[model samples]
Target: MEEQLRELGLEFTKEVREDFVNFRADPLAVVYPRSEEDVIKLVNFAREKKIPIVPWGAGTSLTGAVACKGCILVDMRYMSSILEINEVDWYARVQPGVNLGKLNEELSKRGFFFPPDPASFFLCTVGGAVANSSGGMRGVRYGTFREWVLALRVVLSSGEVIRVGEPLRKNRAGYDLVHLFVGSEGTLGIITEVWLRIIPTPRQRLVALVGYVSSLDSVAGIIIDMRRSGILPEIAEYVDDEVIRALNEHLNAGLRKSGGGILLLRVDEPDSERMREILRRWGVEAEVLNDEEWERMYSLRSQSALALKASAESMYVEDIVVPVSRLVEAVRRLRDLERKYNVRMPVIAHIGDGNLHPNILLERSEDADKIFDEVARLAVELGGSVSGEHGIGIQKAKVMGEQITSHSGKRVLEIMNGIKRLIDPESIMNPGKYVELAYEINRSEERRSSS
Candidate 1:
């Protein structure tokens, strides 16, 4: 493989790589492709050699999505470019390697901005966010990357280049294959270019509300009450006391810590009073902030994971989402797990959407895997997804299989596996993860049951 890659005259390097969550990969060679043509050539060579190919974005993935052994890592950094920002068309055409923050900054100058602001927006690539279908603080109102992506140019495992979906919003020409690859986590194809739907920045006067609650249950109650009262905040986020401590200790963020946690809520000016009334009902006083103060809090929320990382040796960030109705139960279950394991699991959540990120401070603990699986299973039991935004990488494959089998059916898992096989017959494109790994785990369980 090395000789063949050298013969092809590609810019390749041998190195050890690691994702944000410490998932490591030792690739045979990491190839930097400068253009779509370069990606096509590399794909062709990998296909011919039957070597597994993994797409490299900004290395911001929390799951072990990009971790592979002996695989060819297609680093897209060299191809980073903002090709076009069509304000009239309300879309942005960009290379996969473009930094999401940079793209948004450019769009902001034109009075338009992409909505999907993942927590890693400042550090992550647009390709990684699209591939993970990432969600963030704005997810409560704007949705995730899956909703914003309009079209994609992908290089298949057979080295065939194909464009899926159109830049237009109302294209029904075929089966939404654009979405299939959106959160596929580099398992299906290598995305070389992306077209994202852009919208004008909200001009409405917005208010940011900060409050500290008594418990996780109080936070869940507030969200449920807001839902029942028909009050939708622009963004609703929570970071527990432990998370606040981490932020203060690591980032020097002097935050008031309550036994419960801190809640950050943003809403339009018209509904600001209503949001405040709701918080008061919860026995919590909310502080309304100006734009400048809100931006500081927003940045702090985005850096919650990083702050936790600085405080811990190793951390397993579990992205489990339960229905809003069952959030209290989920919190109770989480507390039980913490007590059972005798560990402090700090939480950061997009509470409006029930996407709870329970940071299990691993610290090289052997029982971390068991605790992680238990958290994921709790989501499934409560009729929620194992993963809300972060796709199932190598880490959550087994729990994903269990979720599918329990919620949808065994047939659903089989169909997903079928689609993966149909697309990459040789399993060269980021093989042995996501749907492929989920299907394999399901099959293994079946075999055990039969035995």
Candidate 2:
């Protein structure tokens, strides 16, 4: 493989790589493609040789989505570029390797900005964010990457270059193939270029509030009340006492340790009083923050995962989301799990959306996998998803299958697998994970039942 790639004049290196969560991959070679032509050539070579290919982004995937063995890793760093920013069209066309934060910085100078600010915005690539369909603090107001992506240029497994969707927002041509590839996790094809919808930054005066709550249930209650009262905050997040301690110890966050946790809320200046009144009704004291303080707090919340990672020997980040109505029940069940396992699972949450990330802090015990699956199952039982934004890489594949089968029915899994087969018939594009794995699990269960 090395000799062939060298003969083709492709830039590649042999290396053992690992993702943010330590999911390792030992590829035959990591290739750097500087253009779409290079990607097409590499795909053609891989297809001829029957070699599996995986697209490499910023490697900040918490779900092990980029992990592969004995494959060609397409490193997209050299292709990074902001090709076009059309203010009149309200869109930006960018290469797959463009740093999300850098792109936003450039967009800000033009008086426009992309809205999907994932927690890893500073570290992740636009391609990876689009691939994962990532959501962040602003998701409560702006939605996820899926909502912002307008079009995509993809290189299929057969070396066919195709562009899906258009740069326009209101295009009603054909099926939504753009969305199909948005969060496909590299299973369908490799994205070469992306068109993202951009909008002018809001000019409203916003107020940031921090509420020290008594418990996880209290956080849920506050969010529920705000929702019921028609108070929509731009950002509503929570971090428990253990997470606060971790932040203080590891990141020097200088946060007060409340009895239960802290709730961070941001609202328009006019609605700030209403938001404060809700906190007071819950018997929680609130602190108003200045612009600088709010930015620091937001950065700290984004780095919460890093802080916890430093404090733990091994951490399994569980991205489970329940409905707002079931938020309290989910919290109680999560507490029950912690008590049963006798482990301290510090939680940080996008509370407004019911996306709870319970960081299981423990050594690599035999029960860790069991606890992980149990947490996913709790979300399933509560009529929620196994993953709210994080893609189902190898780690959450089984539970994802369960969630889909139980909620959307087995036929949905079959259809997803069928789509995978249709796009990459040879199963060479990031094979053996996601939809394929889920389908295989379902089929195995069917075999057992028949026997």
Clashes of 1: 0
Residue 124 of model 1, lDDT score: 91
Candidate 1 regions off by >4 Å? none
Q: Distance (Å) between predicted and true CA of 348, model 1?
A: 0.5
The local distance difference test score of model 2 is 0.92
Q: Model 1 over residues 169-269: C-alpha lDDT tens digits?
A: 89989799999999999999999999999999889888899998999999999999988988888899999999999999999999988899999999988
**Candidate 2 lDDT, 372-444, residue by residue in tens:** 9999999999999999888898889999999998999988998999999999999999999999988898799
Worst 10 residues of 2 by lDDT: 360-369
Worst 10 residues of 1 by lDDT: 1-10
